[model samples]
Target: MKAKLITLAVVVVALGGGIALASASSEPGSGPPAIGVVRAVRSGTDIVLPFDAYRHTPAEINVIERATAVLARDCLNRFGLHWAPPTVDAVDTSRPTAAGRYGIVDAAEVARLGYHAAEPPDRPSQPQPPLDVLMVYTGKGASDVGGQPVPEGGCLGEARRRLEEGLPAAMPGERFAELDRELYLTAQADERVQRAMTGWRECMAESGLRYADVWAANDDVRWSAPEPTPEEIATAKADLACRTRSGLAGTWLAVETAYQQRVISERRKEFDALATALHARLAHARQIVNR
Candidate 1:
């Protein structure tokens, strides 16, 4: 069966309110500029950015401020931009039905393992984290330029409505309008590591190899350590050596390198093999489709 991937998008707006709060310095490589998340509150021709509810990184905060500056400079660019911290959406991977609903690993071992996926937040009329900077257009030029009042909503709502209604009728230019929410996310080495890990797990499970300790460490383990310490590097090298000695090192290294490169082409190779096996098993298992 072909894999299925589902991605849901939401839109919310910032809300009225002001409160002062603070946090300690963010860990290096923790996330992007903004400390928390950001959402836009729409009222009339005015757009207010509320930053009170969501957690943000310094990079995330910086991006928001810079984006806001661009908007102001360009007369409130009405494009959707989303800011996200380090996160992945939670997913169920134990069954075949899920293949069509989310990105599937296809291998039974990966199904036993779980994952979380992060999404861009863009809604109107929703509570937003406190703002590092609130953007309110208090001028007559916006109205004079034919800027229509965004119906009451948060950043997400506005994004949805914009998609459904099409860009504002009076948009300065057709190209000036967009519907997809803007996202500010952290840059990582890439998903090559994850894909490689998935393949390794699947291969081990198929061979009846019981490596639960290794399994547990990879599943849902956040990269809390910003920089790899000498000890960590030595550990990785040792682990690779063990896998090599065990004849699985080639597979592990390939996946690891791909992950570092921000790509996981090998994962597809693994997925294809697992999918074929699953097809044969399900044919004889007499399982219901949607139970």
Candidate 2:
């Protein structure tokens, strides 16, 4: 479990950290969301879940990436390499939110993209660093590069070390993700969600779209096109209307929220520890970016 959590923490931090240091330090949230099932309803994008508090915010991601770049840049300079750090920007929203967990929550997005992925931001590509720089940046599991001793995991590894300075051996956030996945699967399989999906299927059938459930509808292969076809748009629009009418989203979220609450209650100590570690790690990353 300790090894797994450390790996998870590394993945989370690698994906990046969140926003302003003042924001990072001012309102730290640690584990086990306190909001009730009722208040959690209709929350933004319906993608939110109790476990979201333990996840890294977009601003945090920005800070992590920026700090990593800064550290990498400094390390590369020792070998007479001129490094231009890649641009790092925080996103407005975090992904894989509970919204899509139940499928097709946003009518507007579905109407526009029709299950196709939203276009990614246009970031101008930065020039790739030289081979020697790459070797130094990643450490490439080497003892030294250009006769200068390389730190374990390279400079990138060093930045992670600094950011995670005070974290426990096991780190925290990843286990939430692991358990959240389990809970999500568990919640959806509940009889209530199964019944709700039945109603949703019937609703979709009225429009002649025969799908086993919401998941089937959302995963329709035709929607994978580079562009949404007119047929796909119509189907998606119908899928959205049926979803609203059947209350499948509402039902699924309710079930999931309840499951999340149960888990939080059961593992309060574990979650609290993870949340605290996340806050501390973010604080360290923010300090790096500002410095």
lDDT of 1 by residue, 15-71 (tens): 122222112122232232222221221111121112111212223333333333333
Off by over 4 Å in 2: 1-11, 14-44, 90-99, 141-143, 169-171
Model 2: per-residue Cα lDDT over 1-291, one tens digit each: 000111123235421322111111122332323323432223236556677676676677777778777777777787666678777464434443343456556666777776665554676667787777787888885677677888888887886676666665433344444556666776677777788788878988888889987666666777666678898878878887877776777777777777776666655665676677777677777787788
True-vs-predicted CA distance for residue 77, candidate 2, Å: 3.4
If candidate 2 were superposed on the true structure by all CA atoms, what would the RMSD be? 8.3
Per-residue lDDT value at 18 in model 2: 26
lDDT of each: 0.27, 0.63
Winner by TM-score:
2
Off-target runs (Cα >4 Å) in candidate 1 are: 1-152, 163-211, 215-227, 244-291
